[model samples]
Target: MAIRAAGEHKQRITINIAIDGLRLRDEKTGDCLYHHPVHKISFIAQDMIDSRAFGYIFGSPDTGRRFFGIKTDKAASQVKCREIDM
Candidate 1:
């Protein structure tokens, strides 16, 4: 396997981002307890933009969970840093 850094890649990296609202239910009661929203962001390396996914970030569904902002910020930064300056 060949390893290439983001800056060394010939093409620009492409990222895929998705957000959705989900209805979570209890297994026993099957009752709709709460509505949760989730965000998923994945990175495709510049070299293998279509062949495979380079990395991914799965955001927490609950905002009350600590470090949510930190995680999201980190993911965003990673994506921004992957871009090659024009």
Candidate 2:
């Protein structure tokens, strides 16, 4: 029997990262199922030490929400939503 770690998601999904936001595209439909804007990307969560970020959170325990069209209350979280000059 193979042992599996908790919170280990092995689903193969296409991820597109652009200047505006990060998107999770459906392989079959070619439709963007999830979108996390660069501004609202609270913090990149790492599952293991020195590992790549597996979670793009919006400064909350809830993952079902947080998107581009969805307006997030910036004042509620510690993150300053001010845009940095590029």
Which candidate's TM-score is highest?
2
Candidate 2 segments exceeding 4 Å error: 1-11, 49-53, 59-86
lDDT of 2: 0.47
lDDT of 2 by residue, 2-40 (tens): 224565634445666667876777767888887667776
CA lDDT for candidate 1: 0.33
Q: Against the unseen true structure, what C-alpha lDDT does each candidate score?
A: 0.33, 0.47
User: Candidate 1 at residue 37, lDDT?
Assistant: 44
Winner by lDDT: 2
Candidate 2 matches the true fold with a TM-score of: 0.49
Backbone steric clashes in candidate 1, count: 0
Q: How many clashes does the backbone of model 2 have?
A: 0
